[model samples]
Target: MTSLTLTRGATDTRTARATGRRTAWVPTLVLILGALYCLVPIAWVVIAATKSRSELFSTFTFAPGSGLLDNLHDLSTYRDGIYWQWMANSAFYAGLGALLSATVSAAGGYALGRFAFRGREFVFKLMLAGVLVPGIVLAVPQYLLMSELDLADSYWSMLLPSILSPYGVYLMRVYASAAVPAELLEAARMDGAGEFRIFTRIAVPMMMPGLITVFLFQFVGIWNNFLLPYVMLADDTKFPLTLGLYTLLAQGASQPALYTLVIMGCLLAVLPLIGLFLVIQRFWSLDLLSGSIKS
Candidate 1:
């Protein structure tokens, strides 16, 4: 009877082990499927961009074609290189807007995180509410406001709305609260440092990671923004990549050959974002490492 009991316990242990191993695989399989789901479309765009207009529909979906150079040459030369103009516009909007947003966010967040004052909670809560309100909901109101100021259909219209990011402020606030020590600020004050000096010299470095996060988020948001620019700008000369590509797509509906250009444009559009991530990721890593060491 004791032998029988021991044998049953061993069998249960083996069963549990097998079940755990199978359970572990479930999450792994799910992750793999999720990755493929996201990656397959990107892969399709890359492959399709290589095909010429004829091969775009005639060739196999995943097959590589030999027209990548031709597509690029055509896209570049199309309508006096307007594609590059769109690229430049997008870069300017995203770059300058993100920089300004990050600066404002850092200042607002540092103040909210470090200071004790009247209505501080109220202000932070208001900003949090702003974060919850979708940008789409505010687009029309923003357009009306810009129009009242007579700034519609200009670069200012594209940029002015992007310079303030409630989400970026919220993120920086949380990060500053945790990352910037009150004791350090006290020490700086004791050493006769001005508030501005303390912020620029001391607090900024400590909050670098959060700032970078905010910058990247704001940059991507402005880069991919469509509705705000669509509502504001009528000129193709000032349109960012999103609206510019959209115009190409609209034209493509009538002229089927433009579809190839659209595909090629999409592939090129993805390159800047990829390069930005790769470049910023290095700084992000270094900041994290420095932070860990400082801690």
Candidate 2:
């Protein structure tokens, strides 16, 4: 038996991709269903925020009601609009802490990626080990240290400790190793650029995509975190949205009026991250995020 076939690069590529897609449908559907499951709560919160307290429980659960403005007004007037204060506090801590953590991670990761120094492996391994230690363990000691320095129950206490992220460091290390070529660093050195200059001019730009991811990761982690801020902060005025919401929910256990407010607050808390992602997407280099960890 004999077979005759004709193929071209463009046609072969198209056919091969088509065949692959035919095999990928099951996994793709599963992923889409998982995404929908995750997004359903978010949808419910949005719809719930639009409803009045009575509508929230009485009306069809997902039906939109006419209470959006009233909810907003109540939230705005609640405790003299302390909810907005909590929101601003979260933004400050997450934004500033993420920026600093990204910078620190970029510096530390770039150095380890491009250069070998005494005890480099030991230090990197120790840092990787730190990532295994849960945030809970650090919360108590970090609180105690902040108290020792008279920084406890303060914004600085939250902002300062949040800036050191082991995961951000690891992400940057992976990103820098893959995205940055050692040749470029050597070329920059050959061009008489100082280490700092090479880093600022060359390495930073190349690693920006990874850095933005690191920043966003850290920002979201800090934004969602409850325990550390809960332990460190005492003043309602200094509380981030997450901690503030926890307090609000705790109060709601005794006073049911706060239930509506908590739902609306949850709706409001999600907007900043969504808005940030949209804004940062245009500037972020996502190509750097694709790579592997060494064994």
Candidate 3:
């Protein structure tokens, strides 16, 4: 009887261990599949970018070619290097727009989070509604409004619309409520710190992580924004990289050589966002770490 009981216990233990391993593999397999799904397209772009016009069509999807430098040269010389102009325009739109948006979001969020005033909840709820409404839904109306202001086809057309991100404001508000303490504001007030000083000095520092998050979101959104820029700008010189790359693709239908340039352009365009993420990730991690340490 004792030997039978021990044997049964050992069998059950082995069964449990085998079940655990199987369950663990389910998520592991899913994650591996997800990674491959995302990476395959990027890999294809990198490989295609290396190919020349002839090689792009002839080579295997994963195989690399030797025309990267030629493709770069062609892209640079195309339309007297308007691609660089598009890049610069995209950088400007994203950089300045994100900075301004983050600033506005910080101010607006801090006010909504910390202050008590008439219809404050109403205003916040209204902003939340704005967040729910897709940007595409607003694009045509924004274009028409820009036209009314005589700002259409101008940089301001892009910058102005981007400056007020409802989502950014919402993010900051949530972050501030959690991150900034009421006691700190009271202490600052007791020290006779003005509202502006308290916000700029105390609130902003406390909310750096959220601010960085909002900045990155807005930066990427503005950089990749297509419909807004397409609707707003007519001048190709003022076009952002998205619209510009689109034009390249459109022309590629007729001029097959432009296909290689377009692929190379996509490869180049991805570099800045990747670099930004890597650089900002360090600061973001440090800020979170410092916040944890302080707490």
Selected candidate, larger lDDT, 1 vs 3: 3
lDDT of each: 0.94, 0.87, 0.95
Between candidates 1 and 2, the TM-score winner: 1
TM-score of each: 0.94, 0.89, 0.94
Model number with the top lDDT: 3
Q: Kindly list the per-residue Cα lDDT of model 3 for residues 130-238, writing each as its tens digit.
A: 9999999999999999999999999999999999999999999998999999999999999999999999999999999999999999999999999999999999999
RMSD of each: 2.8, 4.6, 2.7
lDDT of 2 by residue, 107-187 (tens): 988887788999988878888998999999889999999999999988889889878777778888888898889887888
- List candidate 1 stretches off by more than 4 Å: 1-19
Candidate 2 Cα errors over 4 Å, as ranges: 4-23, 285-295
Which stretches of model 3 miss by more than 4 angstroms?
1-18
Error of 3 at 251 (Å): 0.9
> What's the TM for model 3?
0.94
